[model samples]
Target: MKTPVVYVALQQFCEADAAPRQRLLEAGFEVRQNTLGRRLRREEVPTFLAQADAVIAGVEPYDAEVLAALSKLRCISRCGVGTDSIDVDAAQRRGIAVYTTPDEVTEPVAQLTVAMILALARNFPQHLAASRAGRWEKRTGVLLSEWTVGLIGFGRIGRAVARDLSPFGPRLLVTDPALSSGEAPDGVQRVELAALLAQADVVSLHASRPPHAGALLGRHELASMKPGSYLVNTARGHLVDDAALVEALQSGHLAGAAIDVFATEPYTGALSQMPQVLCTPHVATLTRASRAAMERRAAAHVVEWWTQASCLTPTS
Candidate 1:
């Protein structure tokens, strides 16, 4: 019998470490790594995925067309928590199992969020830039305790961020239509989006990116925010409208913004030119421990599904 082949379409940045590849080999998979040297285009993914028995996918699109092409694909082990990149309904329709490594990424992402909030609150980026330009600038910035933090979604990542922020003593307001007051983490008060928007001195987005066509923060939402309020997004970029955000930042309606993810990745646009805005390559989950944990869990899931084929159907 031929050994089952598992294809890994992880982004190029993810392949630099050898642990995931080695883990797959140790688990007896005939691992076929990236065919394209870079992030695969939409047209390129289905061609390679068609022959794969399983895949560890990145943010590349795996829509109905790609699903139809992957006749042998049993499972899609997502490297991160976000399933916005994958076509979940199409995968379900095709009887393919989908798993996201949410637990692995939660703490790291939460830590990064706290770091960004601190950096923004203290004006660290501006001071650093000024220092680099031979100017010793002493800029007074707002303290975290003086601000109200509005967490847009109270999911695992959001709750983790709230937990980390508890010691800081900022008032915490969370808005998530899916979550009831009882479901909120202790010390977090559930509020309407408008209420959160009006009161929060720093607003952070932590919502899931559903493929649905609507901006989570549009012109009206931005307008609702207090002038000089800060915005931070560790969530998917589309959650906030980039154009509208850029306009708000330019007009000084927003004091500053820190963003990790962008609507279109490898982002180069108007926001990139804004000095007040701090940007990080979508690397909130790139910590050594988190990366290893995610890969290990993803590899283990694939191995378990392959070994227990009779008990677990592709659909499950």
Candidate 2:
């Protein structure tokens, strides 16, 4: 019998810690890590896994073709929560088990969302740019406590954000079909998405991204928002219509927006040119502690699935 091959498709996996690689090697499995030095593109996926039995994937796309081509591919151990990148249904059709560590990803992402929320509230980035450039400008900024903060999704990260914001005493509103009355936090009222959009002074997106699910915040949604209100997205890029968001900002219908992910990556799009929006290169889970925990757990998922044909239970 041949030692099964495990491919590490995530380019940055094991960079902070090598325990994941060690576990695979110790299991009598041959491990191959991505050497691309960057994000693994969809076209490059198949060749990279020419003979893989399992893979620890990042946010790489695994469409029908990618899954059908991999005859030996048995499982996908996702390093993070979101499966929007992987064609999970297609993988399932091919008998590929897809696993994720949603529980391990909550806190880090929540922290970044809070940080961006505060930044938008203050307008300090805009002020700092001017002060450094030899001009001093003073503008009145709103307090978090005074605004109606609406969360678009009530999952792990959204729940965590609602809890973290409690200290600031903002009026919390949430909208998610899955939200339960038993699980609703103190002062957090669950409302419909349209209601959340209409009433919120600061709207934050925490929704899951299902592939082909059209933009949650498109032109009509943006138009529905209270003029001059802020938008923050730590969620998937495709959740917002890029052109519509830009139009909202330009027309002053929205005060500003902050995003952590983009529809098109290595984002050189118009959103970057806007001073009102703060963007991060999908670094929500890039913390050292988060990386270590996710990597260890992600590797464990692959190992367990390889031997027992099941991965760890997902939180969300």
Best by TM-score: 2
lDDT of 1: 0.86
lDDT of 2 by residue, 129-226 (tens): 67877888877888899899999999999999999998998999999988876778679998888888999998999998675888989999999998
Error of 2 at 144 (Å): 0.8
Global fold similarity of model 1 (TM-score): 0.92
Please, what's the RMSD in Å of model 2? Answer: 4.2
> With candidate 1 superimposed using the best TM-score fit, by how many Å does residue 8's alpha carbon deviate from the native?
1.2
- Clash totals for all models, in order? 0, 0
**Model 1 agreement with the true structure over 174-256: per-residue lDDT tens digits:** 99999987988678999999999999999999998675666799989998998899999998988888999998999999998
Report the Cα lDDT for residue 280, model 1: 92
Q: Give the TM-score of candidate 2.
A: 0.93
Looking at model 1, the pairs that clash are none
Q: Candidate 2 overall Cα lDDT vs. reference?
A: 0.87
lDDT of 2 at 190: 86
